[model samples]
Target: MNCEEATKLLDGYLDGELDPITSQQIEQHLRDCRT
Candidate 1:
């Protein structure tokens, strides 16, 4: 997914609402975007 999509999922992830797959994707995105 793109940055916006990843960002949208971030909140749910922080709150532990996302599934494993989605949470993993979001984590990967965060790592990639972290400079």
Candidate 2:
């Protein structure tokens, strides 16, 4: 889950439209990401 991928999913994440697995991935990415 890189920044670009995460960026594309941002809207879905905010809207709570993503699945559990995907949301977890995004959350983990955010935690590990340094930007």
Candidate 3:
């Protein structure tokens, strides 16, 4: 996913509302992105 989607999912992640796949996507994005 893009930064926009990962960024948007941040809240849901913190709130424990997102599914495993979505949360993993965001985690992967953060791991690979540095800007």
Candidate 4:
């Protein structure tokens, strides 16, 4: 997914609402984005 999509999903992740697959994707995105 793209950055915008990931960012949108991140909120759900923070709130513990995302499913495992989406959460994993978001975690990977966070790791890649950490500078």
Which structure among the candidates has the greatest lDDT? 2
lDDT of 4 by residue, 1-35 (tens): 66899978877999999999999988888778754
lDDT tens digits, residues 5-34, model 1? 987888898999999999988888777885
Which candidate do you rate higher for TM-score, 1 or 2?
A: 2
RMSD of each: 1.7, 0.4, 0.8, 1.7
lDDT of each: 0.84, 0.98, 0.90, 0.85
Which pairs clash (backbone N, Cα, C closer than 3 Å) in model 3?
none
lDDT of 3 by residue, 1-35 (tens): 88888888899998989999998998899999988
Quote the lDDT for 7 in model 3: 84
Q: Please give the lDDT score for candidate 4.
A: 0.85
- TM-scores, all candidates, are 0.76, 0.94, 0.84, 0.76
Q: Which one is best on TM-score?
A: 2
- Weakest ten-residue segment in model 4 by summed lDDT: 26-35
Over 1-35, each residue of candidate 2 has an lDDT whose tens digit, in order, gives 99999999999999999999999999999999999
How many clashes in each candidate? 0, 0, 0, 0
Q: Which ten residues in a row have the lowest lDDT in candidate 2?
A: 26-35
